[model samples]
Target: MAIAAKHNLELKQYDVTNAFVHASLDREVYMRMPKGYQKPGTILRIKKALYGLRISPLLWQKDLTATLTQLGFQIVPHEPCCMIKDGIIIFYYVDDIILAYGKDQSKKAQEAMDQLKQRYSITGGDDLQWFLGIEVIRDRSKQLIHLSQVAYYEKINRLVDDQTIRHDTPMATSELMPREGLATPSEINRYQRKIGSLLYAAVNTRPDIAFATSRLARFLANPSQEHQQAADRVLLYLSDTKWLTLRLGGGTAMQVASDASFADNTLDRKSSQGY
Candidate 1:
């Protein structure tokens, strides 16, 4: 997304229908026929890869990598899932592919996509809007791109009851100490679920909650009411700032800042650092 915004490029998404079924099998495999499709006392030999098999993903990846490489797309050394040739970049994740290219190279990108469409049942040729639950909004005129998870946040919010209170910060200023007693089974399960959801949001677009989420995660083994309240505070904060998004491509220069504290962790008494 940042690359698209930086180059003022158009982003296109494509989905390969029945992607796993397309890859040819390289080994002998057999499966029992369905109750209705069974021949009398006979099993079926597997031809194409099936979805449930463990090796299916490997077969698909090998096939895709071979095909893309044959078409002159080079696999990025640092990011194996990314394929690039000229100015056209293709980011492949399983069956989903995102194409990014500048206006001048749009034809080349389309041609590559067309070649893939010829081989597989491709379903998309529209502007990139949503992928992996992240909403992408681009503004070419202003040279900015925003990534948000409002829908995901709302979905998580629905998991819990409505809250009249909202928080400005994800966590309180005071540090949290480990509770004295172990949480009940149900309490532990619920706390872990909430932490998992919040962690996803943090890793995706809500970096503001990253520290709080991480801290809460430490108590997942035996969460307490106070810890649960901290988790709720994070959710309340999300409810209030659901519209917050990560913006990219405002400037060319890269900037970095660092800070550290000695023995900040109350439990471990270790220095904490961040950038």
Candidate 2:
């Protein structure tokens, strides 16, 4: 997504129909006949990959790699899911594909799409608005692109009790200590679920809550009441800032900063560092 913004590229999305079934199986496999197809005692041999098969993804990936390579796109060394040809880039997550190209390469992009359509059954050619649950907002005039998870945040907010108060920050500066008693089984389960949801957001676009979430994760095995409250605070924070997005582009140069604190962890006497 950052690359698309940096290059001022037009983004498009495509979905390959029955993508897994397109890959032919390399090994001979058989399955029992269905109830409706029962005839004597004969079984059916699988000719193509199926959804339940563990090796289906590998087969699909291999097929996609071969097809892209034949189309003059080379798989990126560091990112196997990415393919590049000239200045245009193609990124695929399972069956969904996102295409990015500069203004001058619109024809090339269209041609690539055409080639893909001829090679496989696909439905696309529209400007990208959403992908993998992330809402993509592009402002070509401002040369900016923003990624948000408003719906995802709201969905998880429903899981939280209505009494949770909103907060400006995901966590407090005050130190958190283990409570005197262990949490009940139900309480522990609920805390784990909430933490898991928050962790997903942190790893995706909510870097602001990453540190707090990571710190709270330490007590997952036996979270205390205080820990549960801290976790709830993170959800309340998400509700308060559901519209917050990660913006790319609109900057001339990159800037980075780092910090460190000696012996910041009270329990382990370990130093903390961040960039």
Candidate 3:
């Protein structure tokens, strides 16, 4: 998306109709007829990869890769489901595809899309708006694209509170320690659920909570009242800063920054070789 906005590129969204079913099974497979269509002695021979099959995703991925490769795109190194050729980028998660290319490459983009359509029942082919539940908001005048998970984030934030209270920080200043007290299975599940929601926010658009969520995760096995409060604090923090969106574009370079604590893990204080 950053590249698309940076280059003022054309971004097209597409969905492969019955994506998995388009890939043929590598080996013959048979199944007993489903209840509604069962005949006493009959079995169904499955030729196409079916949705529930374990290898369906792999099969579909391979099929898509072959088609895209044939169209002159090469798999991007170290990136799954990403292909690029001639300044055009095509990446997808399962069947959701986004094709991005600069204005100068518009003709090539359409040609690639047309070739892909021949192999699969493609739909959409419009401006990219939503992908993987994240809303893509574009401001062409400013050449900026904003990614927001507000709809989903709001749904999770409401689980904490309805804005009666807000948090200034995602976690308290004091460090969290695992409880020695026995945790009920229900409590463990509850804590895990909280961490899951927080992790989603952290990964998508809430980097501010990454460290907090990581700290909260340490006590998943044995959560105490304090841990639950910590999780709620993070949730309330989300509620407090709910309107923030992650912006992409407006720059030619991006940087990644990282920091580390001085040996925080308590369980592994010393190693056999060294600390």
Candidate 4:
């Protein structure tokens, strides 16, 4: 995204219709026929990959990878679903695809997409505004993109019923510790679900809450009332500042920053670090 914004590149989104069914099964498979297609003493043979099958995703990935490779798009070293041809980058997850290219390379990008359309029922050629639940807010004039997850935050914030109270910080000044007393199964399950949702935000667009979420994660196995309150506080904090976004753009330069908590963990005396 930074690269796209840096070059003031254009983005196009596409979705492959019935992606799984497009791939042929590499191994023989059989399934019981549906009610409407059932016949006496008849079993159905699966020739094409279907959605519920275990190998369907793999088959689709292989087919798409081959198709992209055939179109001269080289797979990125660490990203199997992301391919690059010249300065244009094409990334896909499951059926959703995004194409990014500068104005100068628009023709080539369109040609590559056109090639893909011939093999797949590709739809959506408009500019990308949303991808994988993250809203892509682009400012071409400033050459920047802001990634926001406001809807996601709102969805998870319902864990706390009372939205009247607001928290300015993700965590309280007091340090979090392991649960000392026994917690009921229901309490533990509740905390786990909240932490799981918070983890998504922390990894995606809420780096500011990473430390707080990590602290709350320690008591997932057995949470106390204080731990639940802390988790709720984090959600409340997010509610207060739901509009915060991560900026990606300006220049093609790399930046890194990290900090560590020195021997902060009482359970193992191990330090926790953030990047």
Could you give the candidate ranking by TM-score, starting with the highest? 4, 1, 2, 3
- Tell me the whole-model lDDT of each prediction, alpha carbons only: 0.87, 0.88, 0.85, 0.89
The C-alpha TM-scores of every prediction are 0.91, 0.91, 0.90, 0.93
Question: Model 4: residues >4 Å from true position, as ranges?
Answer: 161-165, 180-182
Which candidate order results from sorting by lDDT in descending order?
4, 2, 1, 3
Give a tens-digit lDDT track for model 1, residues 66-120: 8888889999899888989998899978998899998899788889988988888
> For candidate 3, lDDT tens digit of each residue in 67-153?
999889999899878999988999999999999998888898899899889889999989999988889999999899998877876
Cα lDDT of model 4 by residue, 69-147, tens digit:
9999899899898899998899998999999999899899999999999999989999999999999999999999999
Between candidates 2 and 3, the one scoring higher on TM-score is: 2
**Could you tell which candidate, 1 or 4, scores higher by TM-score?**
4
Which stretch of 10 consecutive residues in model 3 shows the poorest summed lDDT? Answer: 266-275
Give per-residue CA lDDT, model 2, range 1-275, as digits (tens).
88788768999999999999999999999999988989897999999999999999999999998999999999889999999999889999999999999989999988988998888899987999999898999988878899899999988886575445567888888778776777788988988999999988998889999989988988888888778778888988987898899898887698988877788788788887886
TM-score of 3: 0.90
Candidate 3: Cα lDDT at 75: 92
User: How does residue 28 of candidate 2 score in lDDT?
Assistant: 97
